[model samples]
Target chain A: DVKVTQSSRYLVKRTGEKVFLECVQDMDHENMFWYRQDPGLGLRLIYFSYDVKMKEKGDIPEGYSVSREKKERFSLILESASTNQTSMYLCASSLWILAGGPGEQYFGPGTRLTVT
Target chain B: SQELEQSPQSLIVQEGKNLTINCTSSKTLYGLYWYKQKYGEGLIFLMMLQKGGEEKSHEKITAKLDEKKQQSSLHITASQPSHAGIYLCGADKGYGNKLVFGAGTILRVKS
Candidate 1:
């Protein structure tokens, strides 16, 4: 079975503070994604990495950045955490099979971040 | 407008009842996925449908992709309390492995 683990399940930070959310996958997938889920708004993509050091912005990438220094690890960074940034952050990883299309994404338990 | 739309934002059903949830897309879907998420938890993949007129079942849950490939439905038979959760449908956006998801359908099973 595939396993995706997050560094933290819950976090609290003050306004203007820097925050980091980490995700690691054991399946050696090539694609990693970061998403924020909100009520009524649903899950909106924040950023994604296709390969090491290669990143792409999604629909909502403002106020957030991502790092993929290694294949198993992906990190989400908040430049300056604000109250509006508080959300349930989720990380997912998938394999890119050119012949068969992208595989299903496996998601971590998610981290609920609270900005005060 | 939303690219993917899910009907009946929420549903309340009694145990042993049957219910169906629908997902419609404005564009043709290359791949459609069904997932269930418990409150404050991550999504658990239920099924994936790729071809038109495809149907897959797991236990009491069945999912079908219409012949047009623009719509899908999930039906649960003999629903139980364990079935209560948020159901979300997602589809590929045609590039970069990006997926667009619906707002989700909240299910509450009354025992």
Candidate 2:
């Protein structure tokens, strides 16, 4: 079984504070992603990394950045947290491709961030 | 850009009942995935369908991809309280690893 773990399960921060969410996977997957889930809006991609030092912006990447210094770890950074940034953050990891098809993503338990 | 639309934004069903959720895509889907998320929790993958006219089942849940590969349905039989959660459909955004997801359908099972 694949295991994805997040650094924090819940966090609280004041406005304009810097925040970091970390994710680590034991499967040695090559792809990792960060997403934010909000009520009614669903889960939206924030950023993704395909390899070490490689990153790409998703549909909603504003105010957020990501780091992939190593294969097993991915970090999401908020330049300056705002109240509107309060939401559940999820991290996922997957193999680039396995057996001629895309691999299914395994997700961590998620971190619920509250910005006040 | 590809978009996925999930029908019946929410559903309420009695235990032992059967229900189905549909996911339609604006463009042909190279890969479609079904996931269930408990409230305030991360998503758990249910199934993945790639071929046009393909179906896969796990326990009491079954998922099928339409012939055109633009639509998919998830059906659950003998529903239980444990089945209550948010169901989401995701598709590859033409890129192998990138995905676009639907708004999700909320399910509430009544005993």
Candidate 3:
């Protein structure tokens, strides 16, 4: 079984505060992703990493950044948190066969962040 | 730009009833995925459809992809309260398997 775990389930921070959300996968997968899910907007990708120290910006990567220092872990960083950034954060992992193929993503339990 | 649109933003059905949710894409889909997310929880993968005119079923839930590969439908027969959740359809536009998702359909099954 594939398991993806997030560092926090619920978090609250004030404006201008820096936030870090961590994710770890035990499936030895080569791809990790971060997404922000909001009502009526669905899940928008924030960042994705295919290898250690390699990252790519997704559709909505303006206020967020990512770090993948190791194969099993990926971290999402908020340089300066704001109220509008308050949303559900999700982390997912998948195995990358060759360059790009149909791989099912395994998701974490998600972290609900409240920026006040 | 490619977009995945799901219809009937929300649905409330009685237990034992049958309901269907639709997802249509603006462009051709390389791969389609269906997931279920409960309130305040993570998404649970339900099914994935790649080939056109493909249909897959798990227990009482069935998902079908059209021959055009631009539309998909999820049908749940004899729905139960346990099936209440938000159903999201995602499409892969042949870019490193990155997915674009729909706004989602919220299903509320009342017993």
Worst 10 residues of 3 chain A by lDDT: A95-104
TM-score of chain B of 2: 0.98
Put down candidate 1 lDDT per residue, B1-111, tens digits, no spaces.
339999889999999999999999999888999999999999999999999999999999999999999999999999999999999999988788878899999999999
Which tens-of-lDDT digit does each residue in A17-95 have in candidate 1? 9999999999989999999999987789999899999999998999999999999999999999999999999999999
- Among these predicted structures, which one has the highest DockQ? 3
Please report how far candidate 3 places residue B58 from its true position, in Å. 0.1
Query: C-alpha displacement of B73 in model 1, angstroms?
Result: 0.5
Worst 10 residues of 2 chain B by lDDT: B91-100
* Cα-based TM-score, every candidate: 0.97, 0.96, 0.98
Q: Choose the strongest candidate by lDDT.
A: 3
**What TM-score does model 1 achieve against the real structure?**
0.97
Query: Per-residue CA lDDT of candidate 2, range B1-111, in tens?
Result: 888999889999999999999999999998999999998788999999999999999999999999999999999999999999999999877665777889999999999
Q: What's the lDDT of the predicted structure labeled candidate 2?
A: 0.93
Q: What docking class should model 2 receive?
A: medium
Q: For all the predictions, what are the DockQ values?
A: 0.66, 0.65, 0.75
User: In candidate 3, what are the lDDT values of residues A1-116, reduced to their tens digit?
Assistant: 77999999999999999999999999999999999999999999999999999999999999898999999999999999999999999999988865544588899999999999
Writing each residue's lDDT as its tens digit, candidate 3 over B1-111 gives 689999999999999999999999999888899999999998999999989999999999999999999999999999999999999998886777678889999999999
Candidate 3 local lDDT, residue A112 = 98
Off by over 4 Å in 2: A98-101
Residue by residue across A1-116, what tens digits does model 2's lDDT show?
78999999999999999999999999999999999998777789999898999998988999999999999999999999999999999999999963445678899999999999
Ranking by lDDT: 3, 1, 2
